[model samples]
Target: MFASSRKSSLFSSLFQTPHIICRGSSRNRVISGSDIAASSKVSAQWTRLGLSEKKPQEQKPAYATSDQRMASLSELKEIFRKADAVCFDVDSTVIKEEGIDELAKFCGVGDAVAEMTRRAMGGSLTFRAALTERLALIRPTREQVQALITEHPPRLTEGIKELVHKLHQRNIQVFLISGGFHSIVEHVATQLDIPLTNIYANRLKFYFNGEYAGFDETQLTAESGGKGKVIGLLKEKYGFRKIVMVGDGATDMEACPPADGFIGFGGNVTRQQVKEKAKWYITDFEELLRELDSDSIKMNHNDIFY
Candidate 1:
């Protein structure tokens, strides 16, 4: 009977494909049954969706040829001349990975959150609804999220920090708005030397006993189109004559109508909606700097925001 139960459990585990437990011997580590289940579930999900069902490759894409350049330096400079503040999306925009989704992985709810993220991003579900559902599933402790910071250091895309620095030097206000949690975004803001007050992202709520409670939906970014609303707010609040938004997702593309100029970053994941609609598309931040004529805008670190 016990053997039969074990077999059934194993089968269900495989179907659900939850988490993996790793064990090591003096010789080497061996994958356990739970690992198999998780792997199987992942495979099943991807297969059902027609996704590749494989880990993403780390290599970068080849640069576009000169003929493929969307706009010349002269054209970009004209736009830059009017822009006063630059707003950016955090995940897959300035950084290579999605922050909250990655945090969900650490909490053992990556698959579930990823599914919601997809629906929300693809315009099938409301951003807030998907976000609320995903956050509810994790119930992650603050410490667990902090541990993720240790496990997965937010990787800023090539030339991102330098671009932010340059923008700061040029007296432009740099803002990071993300659908990711504040706990994680705070670290990024600090590392980039951007003011914490200027960072707009989600903040998680906790119980008195340090248990995971829920998220502050008010501050958290709503699904994809929420970015456009944020752009509107910033424009109204700052009265900035020109606004530029940089991102690489469907949501970021929505900002085009609200923003004065939209710059798409293909350095990370490039969505067709964003690529097609963006005012300018560049693979990396360096391309933007080059297009903007970096030499003239370069200023001292402290010269920014003057």
Candidate 2:
């Protein structure tokens, strides 16, 4: 995705300031003075065509084109090259469904539980509080939860296994931090070759009848910016020079500002806030891995077992 001629210049620009109109990968085409003046005239024309004459900030750059705005994988690759570790969120980030919402579906409270889940994810409600209320409503049977997991396994996002394997090759630790159930993510942790100790997520409690009682509230993810806490903990433990975070939720956004780089995975679900705040936004894991210069590793859906 690199425009070799402009790649270096783009990097230079990006590092020049935190905020600027980034000339995307394909945006380096030369424009003469006449073209620039013509562009300004065109902007004035377009402004006159609008409902109001209020002009937008500097008018659209006459040179900006759809191709120029197209995001390239090279920027992300450069950032990841020096990254020491990447922390991923499980549900929706690595896995497809919100675990509790899936459980709610199995237990006949899908709509209600899903609503709460959305609110929690959308920043309307606290994750821990919502989780408690939802779990209380859908006291699912162990068989049901296990069955759902069996039917719909926790599949890793596209190219995630390859990314993980590449990180492994570099001896960089990968941590799966989630607010989802341990029963599910544990299997995924094993498949991804991440240690159980590195898999920080919520745990479930069951009764003698193999029915769900509730979730363990003691997990770090139950708190606000739980993912950030994990990031902080890892930073303190490993003393790494740089850390990267990858996820697809508000919870993930909390860690974005704290990490050296934050990649938003929009393959499963894309949130506007996440897309806006992430250091990089990608529609799939393949692009993410490719951008990170970690494409050499092989991956498969089986890497994220149920």
Candidate 3:
């Protein structure tokens, strides 16, 4: 189980406006007061596509069950010991809430949107169809979008910050790749101290009057197997010998052949297909840290960093 204290720490860090410090650079870097003000203004203007409201309680789907979906922690630890990079799916894997679903709720179409999301994630519906349908239903306004950011910010998954920090210390490049919208994902990447350039997701377009228009059709993540394609590109560009994908959806599982490993995360929502297919599955991120600390898995720092 995820500890309450860890969740608290993650929430605290995520909501605060970051004052990024540049390390190992001769030019001392500090986020200027003006810059912070500008960021806050932009966040205020284009945050999320929802109004502030109590999130409806999410019911676990009947499909989720207690099954042996993971290898022994030791086995997983050994498998990932040499990973040079890690890619994470944002929505349910790294955050406790689904951004689009929340937006739909704010638009008073929660049930409809939730059903489509469930189908899409379960591999019953194509991601492109689901996204297109849901976006049309919501038709979120500019003000509503910004309110979603300010009023109902996405909550971080338990122990994710610690996991990311540890991976960074080990020189593993952490990337957040999602089928979600870039408007929200960009903020998440910034909060986690992940470079914006490393983040990949769909981008939404708004009319000059701030009305919802549509999304960029050209983004690779707009269709099925997009996550896998992104992973393939990363491998080609970085020449990473070993890469891992951590997510809670079938889309994440699609990255397996390109990614050396796939770890299913079910802390928020569990999908039966992902649980069954993943080589390892965990409900708590702390389990990963514990496995990484095991002595049986020798850390080859050189192989991972260089």
Total clashing pairs for each candidate: 4, 1, 3
Q: Give one digit per residue, the lDDT tens place, for model 1 in 212-299.
A: 7776655537545667677767777777666777888767766655666677788888687677766677888887677445446453
Q: For model 2, how does the per-residue alpha-carbon lDDT over 31-51 read when each residue is reduced to its tens digit?
A: 899999987897788778884
Clash pairs (backbone) in predicted model 1: 17-37, 127-223, 168-304, 171-305
* Best-fitting candidate, scored by TM-score: 3
Rank the candidate models, highest lDDT first: 3, 1, 2
**Which stretches of candidate 3 lie above 4 Å from their native place?**
1-76, 119-124, 295-306
- List ranges where model 2 is wrong by over 4 Å: 1-79, 121-124, 294-306
Error of 2 at 211 (Å): 3.0
lDDT of each: 0.69, 0.69, 0.75
lDDT of 2 at 58: 65
| Model 2 local distance difference test score | 0.69
Q: What is the TM-score of each candidate against the true structure?
A: 0.69, 0.67, 0.71
lDDT of 3 at 83: 82
